[model samples]
Target: MIRLLLVDDQELFLQGLAMILESQEGLEVVGTALDGEQAIARTRELQPDVVLMDIRMPVLDGVSATAAIRRESPEPPPHVIVLTTIRHDEAVVDALRAGASGFLLKDARPEFLVQSIRAVVEGQQVIAPAETFDLLRAFAPVRPAPDASILAELTERERELFALAARGLSNADIARQLWVAETTVKTHMRAILTKLGVASRVQLIALAYEHRLIEV
Candidate 1:
């Protein structure tokens, strides 16, 4: 089962999410917190598989809480999906920099929310398309050129794959674009991850921007 903990200041929204997710098989709502501090406490106590953390809260904010949670080594920090009303807000960037696995807008559909949770828990990252462009542009001016030395390690095919990845293409999308099977794309993705030393595509995009591998 995919155990989940919700941290939101809005009771109605929290209850609504719990209600929507409870009926789904293999998905469980293990706990709820009205603020970031409680969320951290519940995390230490419940040890959930995923956390839906609100970016703004009373006692502490999600960014600081995510940083705190990540600092606890060997305890296995839950993958966090920061919930925000604004798309690509500076707070969202701060949360990601602090090690959040993903971000979801509060207005996102229930299905999308579920998908975000599943993706993050399974070691994938998801950011809204608009948010991605915003993030890329944040580092555009001062970003260094793509490290050709590091990229030279890539095979020709891997080079193409890396470029598609930097453009935020999904494995399936890259497969279609490259006329390869999805499983083949997965293999290339693993290679890309190893070559880039990135945990997820969000980080990959950030690195690509930082290295000027992709244009703004």
Candidate 2:
């Protein structure tokens, strides 16, 4: 079963979500926290596979909390899905930089939420297609330029993998497109992460953009 931790300031919403998630097969709401502090504490103790975190909270916000939790966790930190009302481009960029596995609207459908958790746990991203254009536009004014330097860090195959990742393609999608095994894609991704000095795919994209290695 996929273990989950819910962290949101809304008591009613947290409890309601816990109940709803618990009812779903192959998933379990392992714990709930009201703020970023409690969320970090519970995470240290529970070590859940995924954390459903709210962006705004009383003590600390989701972005800071995600960064803290990610730093404290062992390699391969637990996946974090930011549940927020804010869909602003800045917020999305900040959340991704903070190491969140995904940014999802608070009212996302239950099935989608569950799928996001599973996808993140499986080392795949789950960006909402509805927000893709908006996010891409956020970086449109100064679109990335061609940079041959990035190619030095990746092998030919790894470059192909990173290109797909730069385009926001999931591992499964990249695997199918390349006619390679998903495990191979994952291996290339790990090398990309190490060479690029980024912990998550979000940062990978951010770095790629900063270095003019990839265009949106």
Candidate 3:
């Protein structure tokens, strides 16, 4: 079962979302918090597997809370999915930079919300590639050209796979596109992560954008 914590200042929305999530199979609403401060306290207590965090809240906000949880928590920190009303808000980018696993628009379909939770838990990105590209293009800061030495670490095939990954292709999709086995894709991804020094696919994409590695 996926243990989840819901964080939002809106009491009604918090309770309502908890009810909906708890009713789904394989999900357990372990706790709820009204703000980021409370969310941090409950997280230390409950140690949930995932946190559905609101971007704005009283006392503390989701982005700060996510940073705290990720930086201070023990190994296997809970994955955070920021909830935002605005699709292209800069706060979404801040949240991701602060170590959130992903973000979902508050009005996202119930099925999509559930799928995002599962996807994040399974080490996959929830944000669509196109949307992520747009977000990066709009808000990501300019950086010096990507380090040639760093780029040299990846083989030509690995670079191709990394470019596809930055474009938001799933492992299965990448495998199909490259006419390789899913396991092969997974192996390549592992190597890519090690080479890039990134912990997740989302971070890899972010790094690619920050370094202007892909045109996106």
Every model's TM-score: 0.82, 0.88, 0.91
lDDT of 2 by residue, 1-216 (tens): 988999999999998899889998899888999999999999999999999989888899888899899889976688888888867646666777778877888888989887878878877777753364456457433334566686696788888888778767878898999999989888889889889777678667666666667654
* Cα displacement (Å) at residue 7, model 3: 0.7
Report the C-alpha lDDT of model 1 over 1-216, residue by residue, as the tens digit: 999999999999999999999988889999999988898888888888888899999999999888887667244568888888977477776777677877888888888888887877765667854577685575333345456566767789998988888787878888998899988988887787678665567766666766777776
lDDT of 3 by residue, 165-196 (tens): 98789999999999999999989998998898
Q: Report lDDT (Cα) of residue 12, candidate 3.
A: 95
lDDT of 1: 0.79
| Comparing 1 and 2 on TM-score, the stronger one | 2
In candidate 2, how many Å is residue 21 off?
0.6
Residue 119 of candidate 1: its Cα lDDT? 79
Clashing pairs in model 3, backbone N/Cα/C closer than 3 A? none
lDDT score, residue 17, model 1? 90
Q: Which clashing pairs does model 2 show?
A: none
Which 10-residue window of candidate 3 scores lowest in summed lDDT? 142-151
